[model samples]
Target: MDLTVIWAFIIAFAVFAYVVMDGFDLGIGVLFPTFAVGPERDRAMNSIAPVWDGNETWLVLGGGGLFAAFPLAYAVILPATYPLIIAMLLGLVFRGVAFEYRWRDPGHRRAWDFAFSAGSLVAALAQGMTLGALLQGIRVTGRAYAGSWWDWLTPYTLLVGLGTVAGYALLGAAWLVWKLDGAGQAHARRLARGAALATLALLGLVSLYNVALRPEYAERWLTAPTLWYALPVPVVTALAGLALLRALGRDTHAQPFFLALALFALGMAGIGVTIWPNVVPPSLTIWQAAAPHRSQVFMLVGVALTLPLILAYTAWSYWVFRGKVGGDGYH
Candidate 1:
């Protein structure tokens, strides 16, 4: 396979992993307000406390890889979306501080909780808007960003941002359903039902909005050759959505979480189908933005070695922390 293509898939996988892994914990924070005070909230927090920090590793890997292997794309994209990126980073910082401080200082736990929820919500929204702005196409002039500062803040971007929030909320609800029992689980089920509906509705809206944003998107998905590749995404996404709703109603625990993740996976697949070969969208193909062959090969060697290690340890952590959390478990 071509080295640039290999690097592209690697970066894509890293990003996908980050979204699915960190997404749930962020979702937990988004749903934090609805959680009852005391044990209910504590159990919700404890459910993610062990694996939350580690989940962000993929974000670092994805960003660092993009900078290393696709510097041009990163340079242009970052400048165009500086506001969103800054907001996302700041949100992450506050979320991390809240996560740590909530435990250290009980006297100010409520403030920390607010910080956590606000930070998570902001981070999720910013990330989604960044994706939207990129998809809607960043204005590029001779390999540099030519767009104004506020270009990232559009009605379409806002729709995607809200969609992302709803999706994360669904993931969080599904996670709670799997990780908690009794009343907490029941409450999570109720939340998941509503979140699932909102996520699916917004997913449809985003896909339609994407097509309307650019004819290229419409051609890619609706035209021949590409249509064959794109056809199954919607079909499978619908199935996953149905399965998720069914799982939410049933006695199953892990099914709801995994099925919810499937919905995200399908959505990512749809995006890949729509924008493959293009790193910055409407322009800047992966080949155009890729680093030199030697740099990519050298980096690939390191990724090949470390990727498995990251996956192994991440899996190990989850396995170690498996089973329902209740009454101050694993805290």
Candidate 2:
């Protein structure tokens, strides 16, 4: 198998894992406003406490894979979206600090609560805007970033930022369905319904923007044979979204959360398929962005050995902490 192909997909896997795992914790933070300051909010925090750190672990792997496998692309992507990238990291730092301090002292719990929610909001929006910028296209000229700093700040990307907030909120609310009971569960279901609707609407707008506005994306998607394979991605996303909407009314817990996750996965897959071979938009192919072949060959071994263990450890951690958040949160 081609090492370039292998590494490219490896990077994709890492990114997907990060989004799904961290997405929920981010969602939980986003859902902070929905709950009042009390045991309910405490329960919501505890629901994600055990896994939030673990969820962020994918970031290192994903970014590392990109830097190592496709140095040129990584080089360009960072500089092009530096402000958003810095915002994301800074927001995460604030969120992490709030999580730790919120538990240690109750005197200023409200302050910490604000920090956590604000941090989540900033991080989610920045990350979403980064995604939008990438989808819109990175200005790459012969292995260097050629776009202005403001290039990433477009109306469509900002729209994507808003949509991402709703999407993650959906996941967070669905998680609440799985973990909370009584009023919490009911509130989460309501949030899920609203979030799903927003997501559906944003999905339509994004599709229209990509198809009608971005000619390259439209050309590839409409004209290429790959459309046949890629069509199922959106179909699966729609089915999952619809199923999740339906399941939210039922008594099922994990089903709604799982289906929501499937929706995220399928949407990502659709984007991946649509932009295959191009590491960046406007004709930057993977091979062109790839690092030295020797570097790729050497890293493959480490990836094969390391990735599964990390995934297994993550799985085991989740299994150990499985079930609802009962028993008086945080001692």
Candidate 3:
């Protein structure tokens, strides 16, 4: 068996899970200011309060997996995008503090709310820029990153950052639509409509930019052979976007959120198609970046034993917290 390939998939799954699980809550934080204060904002917070922290578990797994299973990639990628990573970490920390203190200190709730929104927005943008920086390809020499500190601060990266913000806001709006009812749901539906339009527009721009930015990506999508693998992603994504718009317009609750998730899944698939086999991109393949075979096998054993338990408990938590979140709490 190709242990390197297995580890690659494991890390990909971990990152995807982190994005899917944490994206909406971050989106909620991004859209927090738009909601009416008091009950509306409180309900939005209540909806995600139970699962938000749990969602970050996948992030730890993804980062740690990279360090252990693909040390070379970790070593190179970190230096290439250190500023963005630090920004992301700081945003998470501040938002986490704001999340807890808002409840404990009602007198300064407004300030906490601002901190939460700003932190979440910064984190989301930083994460997206980090992705863009990676996709734009890192400068590597020998076994290390040879890029300057500001290599990540390009126009293309900024566009991706904006797109990420729009995408997360859409997810947040869809989530609120799913989890709230009455006036809050109606408001969320309105927000979702705007967010949907913005997200789809940005997704198209980002896709086109991606093609123009890298010949490899363009060849993958426009040429033969790999073209077959690449074609369905955008087509299916468009269909999903249409369905999401339709769901938002109707009386449906859960469908919009799931469709939004479908869009994210398609985005991830597009990324996989773009950068397959290369963990650091441009040059380094998974096999070249991976740790020793014995180490991989050992890590796989631990993951095999622990992953199921994590999945089980995550599923159990969601099940336990199922249904709408109202003014007071879950109903």
Candidate 4:
């Protein structure tokens, strides 16, 4: 594979991983209000605490990779999606602050907990909006944003935004099932089942709408043999969704969450492949937007070493934090 192509795939994969991992924590935050009081919420928070910050490493890597490897695309996309980007950052800020303050201020823990949950909801919504806007394609004229802010908030984009929220919520519920036991696990399983159904409906709607609105995408999928191969992603994802439902019904926690993550991974991979060669989609192809070869080479060397370290540390942290959370305790 060409160097630029390799970097593109690596960066895309990293972003997808971040979405699948950190996404659940954010979803947990969004779902906090529903779970209510005491050990349950604390367990939910604790389940993600050890690795939440580390999960963001991939976001940084993905963004940095785009900046380094595809400067033009970054310039175009950042300018086009500045509002949503700012919203996402603000949500992250709220979440981080809430994470620290909720633990320290016993007096106002309830308020902080709500803040954390709200932050998560806001962040997930913003991310979904951003994804929707990107998929809808930015209006670029000679490398400049040629559209108004309202252009990013179309009906299709709104559908995708809500779809992503449901998707992340499902992931979060799946996570809770695995991380907590007894009442918490049961509650989480119910939440997961509900979220999964909503996600399935939203996914179907978004897929149908996008195909009709952007017929080119449908053509690509139908015409290209390689793209046809990517169809199994959705197929397998649906099967996994069914399996998760079955497992939830049987009160099987561990396997359901793993299967849910697989479903997410497969969907992400399908999109990545569908949009391959086009980092910014519709307009800027990776090679067309890529920075100088020397810059990409230099960045690759550092990324090669650091990425593994990040992965290892993340895995180790999860391993250490593995098992049940209880009684609003800190260790």
Candidate 5:
């Protein structure tokens, strides 16, 4: 296989990892007010506090991989999706500020908490919108974006944005089930059940819409050999969702969360396969968007060394903070 293709896969995997890992935590932040209040909220925050920073490392690596290995794709995508990118960054900034300020100032803590939730909502929504727009393909005339700003913010994009929020909420709820106990656990389970149902419905709707818009996708589904191969993803996702539901019903916490992550991974894998070799769906193929060989080679050297270190530190950080948050005070 080509080195560019290998780098592309690595980068895609990194981004998907970030989404699956950090996505649930962002969902937790967004849904904080619904299931938690005061100290419970603090505990909820504490549950993710130990490893949240490390989880974001994948995003840096993913973005850097794009800039280094596929500079042209980066240039095109960043300019076209500038607004959504800015929104995502701003949300991250607000979330970080809220995370710090809520713990420091007793009186204005509520304000900061609100900021955190709002930020998470904004960032998640923006990301989903970007994904939808990318799948729909940009109007690229030569090297420039030809689409209007309004074109980027369509009804389909908005629906996808909401779907992403629901997906994250499901993830967060599953996390909470594993981390909390008694009332918190019960609450999380309820949220998880509801979120799972909603996510499934939204995913179904999106899949239908995607196939309707691109009839080729339906053809892909109809073809026996291809459909048989593709069936594993949705099949696995459905099985995971069922397992999560059963685990939640049985009050089996840990397995449900793990299964929830598996369901997310399966969904991501399906989409990745659907859009293979197209970093900017429909418009730019991976080979067309890749940077020069020399540039990619140089970037690979740095990634080869640093990626493992990042993964190790991330794993170690999570290991260190493995236990429940409880009333042990903030770290």
Candidate 6:
């Protein structure tokens, strides 16, 4: 494989990691209000506390990789989706602050809880909107963003945002099903089933709408016989959704969580397949947008050294924390 192809796959994998890992944790934050105001919420928080921080490290890797390996994509994509990116950053900051302070200041736990939920909601919504806008294509004028601020505020974008929220909520519920027992698990099962159905419906709707609206995507993923292999992407996503539904009542705990993750992973796989070679669709490609060879070579050395360290600690921490969570965490 070419060097650019290798970096592209690596970057895509990093993006997938962030989406699957931080995706569930963010879902937990979004579902915070579903739990009661006291120990229930705390237990849910404890379920993710051990690994939530590392979950986001993948996002940093993705952004840094893009900036290093494909600076042009980072530049154009960011400018096109300016509002969504800013809002997402703000939401993440707010959520992180609330996560930490909620533990430190008992007096303001309730307020912190509200902040956390709102932040999670906003961030998830923004991410969904960004995906929607990106799929529809960002407006570029002479290699610069020329769209209005509200350009991304389309109905399809809003619908996709809602779908993303539902998907993340399902992931969160699945995690809870694995991490808790008894009452919490029961609550999670209910949430998981509902969110799964909702997500499936939304995913169906988004695909149908996108195929009708974006002819380029339709041509790339459906009309072309060569791309037929990518059909398994959506197929796997649908199967994962069904598996998640079936696993809710099953005795296994990890099955539901992994099944939910499988849905995310399969979907990402499909997207990567559809957009292969193109860092930004209908326009820029990986080779077209890549940084100089010298920069990629230099960055490769750093990524090679640091990426393993990140993965090692991430795996080790999860292994160490394996087992059900009971009672409030950090007590």
Q: lDDT of candidate 4?
A: 0.82
Tens-place lDDT per residue, model 3, 181-268, is 9999999999999999998998899899989988998999899999997999999999999999999999999999999989998999
User: Model 2: residues >4 Å from true position, as ranges?
Assistant: none
Q: Tens digit of lDDT per residue, candidate 5, span 249-294? A: 9958678778877877787777775677688866688898888888
Superposed Cα deviation of residue 290, candidate 4 (Å): 0.8
TM-score of candidate 6 versus the correct structure, residues matched by position: 0.95
Relative to the unseen true structure, what is the C-alpha lDDT of residue 25 in candidate 5, on a scale of 0 to 100?
Answer: 87
| RMSD in Å for all candidates | 1.0, 1.4, 0.9, 1.7, 1.6, 1.6
lDDT of 6 by residue, 208-309 (tens): 887776677777667657457867777778777777778887776889888888887776776666566688776778998888888888888888999899
Better of 2 and 6 by lDDT: 2
lDDT tens digits by residue: candidate 2, 4-94: 9989889988998898888888988998977978888999999898889988889999998999999988999999899999999999999
Q: Give the per-residue lDDT of model 4 (tens digit) for 61-173.
A: 88888888888888888887888899889999999999999879989999898889888888898888888888878777887778786777788878888888898898999
Write the candidate numbers in order of decreasing lDDT.
Answer: 3, 1, 2, 6, 4, 5
Off by over 4 Å in 5: 329-331
- lDDT (CA) for every model shown? 0.93, 0.87, 0.93, 0.82, 0.81, 0.85
Q: Give the CA lDDT, 0 to 100, for residue 241 in model 3.
A: 93
Give the 10-residue window scoring lowest on summed lDDT in candidate 1.
322-331
TM-score of each: 0.98, 0.97, 0.98, 0.95, 0.95, 0.95
Error of 3 at 223 (Å): 0.7
Model 6 lDDT, full chain set: 0.85
**lDDT at 305, model 4:** 98
Greater-lDDT candidate between 4 and 6 = 6
